[model samples]
Target: MRTTPAGGVVLVGVLAWISGVLQLFAGVLMLVAGDHPVTGWLHLLVGLATFPVCLAIFRARVWARIVLSVVFLFEIAAVVFALTDLRFLATPAVTSAVLAVFGLVLLYTPSANASFRQATIDRRNRAATAR
Candidate 1:
């Protein structure tokens, strides 16, 4: 069990935090536009949720990795579905697809896995010692 997280994990954590911030900003902008109230609120809730998930990822929590993996998978799936409409080269869709791929790759890298495993072991050890 290593004390330091892998570089990839740190990168993923930072990206996750950035994503959360962007979501929050976008949500605020949507609300200011005074339209799409449902979507705006949804973005706000998700943005709020992302902070804790990013924090957990930074702490190398395995559950966070799993949750992020699932989220990325859905992102990719949504992008693919959008592409089915034959708008294959839309900038936003393509960018999101690329980011999702990158995130999945980083989350599943060997070093990231090792970091998560080590963190879990460290946590269990701390709990045992506390008890």
Candidate 2:
């Protein structure tokens, strides 16, 4: 496994922490409050749980990409569903949708791929040169 640079590590850490907090709050709201939340709290909980996956990405954990990708897909579906049902007008669904798409873009872009590869390669090269 390749180690991420300090800056990348910090970025992932902050993202993971913030996302986890948001997920937990959202999940609890859906599960424990309101007459009728748009969705189940379990989804929120799962999202929160998956927050660590984002952090793992910086560490180049293979599973992190797969998991985050799945989360983004789910967010896209949720956005589509909300828009179709006119729920977007009632809540922050549109904003959430936009954020998810942004994440998707980041994950799928060639730049991100190249960056990941470069990071990995650089780490290997540096390690080899050190020896």
Candidate 3:
């Protein structure tokens, strides 16, 4: 019998998806601005990458959880750097960092761990059965 997934992970996943969508929108805006092509492209790249991570997390993939943790780490770093000079953007930067932290914390809860572990086993079993 499969256990119900923890609510914390589900909330985190939804937040992550919302973040990814926001990034995609921001990337499009930057691209339209046509000031720094590289930055815009990087945003687009990260935003695009976030979708798969979001999907994997909902599916209880452990690696996706790890990847998201690392991503949030980078996000926190980015916000710190941005805060140094971009005072006008401080609100958004801090908000992003806080959400990242929240996601990271939820990703490590006991229920979240069990959900991911079970998913890993299920994935392995399916793979073996297919072979």
Whole-model Cα lDDT of every candidate shown, in order: 0.66, 0.56, 0.69
RMSD of each: 4.5, 4.8, 3.3
lDDT for model 1 comes to: 0.66
TM-score of 1: 0.69
How accurate locally is residue 13 in candidate 1, as Cα lDDT from 0 to 100?
75
* Top TM-score prediction, candidate number: 3
Model 2 RMSD in Å is 4.8
Encode model 2's per-residue lDDT on 4-77: one tens digit a residue: 43444345445445544554455444445433456535447546765767767766554576787677567556
Which tens-of-lDDT digit does each residue in 55-106 have in candidate 3?
7787777788888887778666655544453445345445656877888999
Q: After superposition, how far is residue 50 of candidate 3 from its true place, in Å?
A: 2.1
In candidate 2, which residue ranges exceed 4 Å CA deviation? 1-20, 34-38, 79-94, 120-131
**Each candidate's clash count:** 0, 0, 0
How high is each candidate's TM-score? 0.69, 0.60, 0.75
lDDT minimum window of 10 residues, candidate 1: 81-90
Error of 1 at 86 (Å): 19
Better of 1 and 2 by TM-score: 1
Highest-scoring model, lDDT: 3
What global local distance difference test value does model 2 have? 0.56
